[model samples]
Target: MNVQSKYSILVFNRENELFLPLTEFYYYQQKRINESSALSYLITLERFFSWLAKSSNYQGTRVKWSDSHMAIRTAVENYLIYQMGCKLRSKENFQYVIMTKKSPQTINHFLAAIKSFYKTALHLKLYEFQNPLVDADYSISIGSFSPTSIRENKPRLPKIAGTEIPSDSSYRSQSDSYFKLVANDWKPNIIADHDLPYIIYRAGSEIGWSLRDEVVIRMLFETGARINEILELTLGDYRQRINQYEIATLNKGSEKRRIKFLRFSQDTLKLLMRYVNGERKTYAHEKQTFTKLSDSEVIFLTRRGDPYNYNAFYSQWSKIITQAKIKMNIHKTRHWFVTNMIRNIYDTASDGGEIEMKKNELINYMKWKDPETIKVYEHYFNEALFREIHENMAKKMQEYEKEYLKKSHSSSEGEQLSSSVLQTKAILPTEEIEWINEFYKGME
Candidate 1:
């Protein structure tokens, strides 16, 4: 469909017949899945389709794909060959750079996108083809194609055999696996323990901030919640439950869970209640963009009495971090919370005392999907935490030993002094002693 050099989505052709089903598939996911999660699928779909439109084998001087017959195996093979020879343009440091081929992860994304498209399209009866991506081991079904298990959800995508990859621009086939590119490893900057208090204190130092801002900062530290999760907290979560204060929140994954502030006392809850009763309404008074504060039920509001969006929250966070002069960011607070909890609990468990920290407990507290990801990515996942905790416990034990020795010396002197005092009291006149005691009581 070379109707134009550019592909107009509005104009349909046999080429579009190939692309439309995939567009519909991802669009359906965007509507159903969380928007943030769906964005990746949508981006990948567009990239794959755009490549298909431009690829020489797929679209070279072709008017209609529906008119010309192509087998699924031929389509997949041609696409894979094109990918190996593809040179991509990107801007880095204000300069353009051409990449020889896509990374392995990107190559895998293409496979996943096409596989999902074909599977979904076939199921909906939108179109049908012999899907070359499917292995004989698994039966494809549209009615129940979605996997429930985490393992099944993340099944390894089949890669195009290295033998099929083109060696040069001439399209000579290569039997080697030299074209694959690996994804960079994730390395998070660890946040220190004391950084949180300094940040919160600095946040409070700012003028025109009601308890709403303070609550936002404190709740983030207290719950180890993501910023979006705290921002989305509703007034309904603040309602009293069974004579106790509790807050329910939805995390990044859209999993709703309750946070009972046991670590933070009722006094902390009182600060929140105070905000609800008075400070929430007061935000509108100081805000230039003030409107009806009742419009949004979200707990955290901006100076405009509008809900705290990502931009507003990040801006406020940047100001606080700048004033605090700390190397930590917002997410580092979550890291700080978990790291300190694990370290402190481990330090307390010395000398055969039962360990209060548990993997399952951390998973539930942080509202993580599973233990594996947290282990692989979070603070407690590394042996560095164990080393830090062990060192902390050793220092605490030494301090305790010094205090015990000092107490023992004081006790010895006190025992002798007590004996002398008893002797002196025995020798004193009972009436005089009683009189002195009564005089002291009268003064109190």
Candidate 2:
């Protein structure tokens, strides 16, 4: 029986035989994709292989030895059509049953996995034939279809087509439009500031509640850190005196490490210390006693004393929100923090220098390489601040005009200036104001 594992991905053929070539490819892809991602790719491969074994186009021949590109292309098209008409029963009890067609995005993802698999196989010399998908574009329009083949009234399925690969700039340009379309309607789900106390209370209110969940929730909102970053925290990362924690990243193959510090509230600091000294201590002690269990230094741990994985943390979060009667996801905590932080900036940043200072602080606290990333967070454009900016600019302009008029009155050019000012009627004429209004009207 095949059991899905996060540490490694396993693929089996229809005959329940181990598939080594694709399994090795999963390991080779570790630097780029995590084990969970690799498992998804392996599953795509497993389904394709299973289909290939039964496909009449190849007469039960292995895909690697199927030299005819036309036969392979036909089989792939048929497989996609098959997938479009199916749905999974469940993750644990896996089987594809008849359902409405899958989305184009999903089919494209499957194509990507299959393409990557073939590329790896070729690089590893596991396949003798040239990659059948070398010229395939995996776009909405995939291949040739007869006039009567597709139902005219229904949504058209993707047809396979051989097209030139898109340039990086062209792809990015297309992606920008897609991103804008998504961004137009998508707003971050954030917990309002007034509701946070109740939510926090609910997080820790349940009977047999783990202190770790409350600590994690508090830290996420206080530090505005990524969920993975919080989950990966260790004992040495925290500084109790400063109420701050250090986040360090060593890239997959890099020797150098980059570090950043994030501070939390004193209240959060107390909760963190409590979890570390109380609940975490118990889990660590249990882990030490169990020789079979690997000792992990992560601050958050499961009941079994194992370090908390993303899935485990998410599951815990789901239950907490359900109990709290809140609809917010865990990631929204970061959004809530950032959105409220920006609101604080609006409250305190009275001058340009102060605004810049707060901007830098935001960038540093978020540990974002690109300052532009802050735009992704939810923000309210303070109407009061906007009006204040226009008022300040008008005041400055008036002050400058007054000083200019005083200078002109005393200077030799005063006669010419005074005559021009008189003609202009206080240096801002009704006609000029009307012109400005007309320009704004054009804009409208």
Error of 1 at 92 (Å): 24
RMSD of each: 19.1, 15.9
lDDT by residue (1-444, candidate 2, tens digit) is 996755454656667887787777777776565443555576676777776776635555544323565566556655655644433232221222223435233454465566677667788888766566555332433334344332211111121110112223322332101101111122344444757745656665773467888777777777777676677766545522243443343222123333665667777777777776677768674433222324235678887778787667766777777777767656577767877787788678899799778978887766554465555452444544577799999998898788777877777685766666685577687889799989999999
Q: Backbone collision count in every prediction?
A: 0, 5
Tens digit per residue, CA lDDT, model 1, 157-219: 222211111223221111111122233233334455565665566656763455776777776
CA lDDT, every model vs. true structure: 0.52, 0.58
What's each prediction's TM-score?
0.45, 0.50
Candidate that would win on TM-score: 2
Off by over 4 Å in 2: 1-204, 239-258, 286-296, 321-330, 375-444
The positional error of residue 157 in candidate 1, measured at the CA in angstroms, is 16
- lDDT score of residue 270 within candidate 2: 74
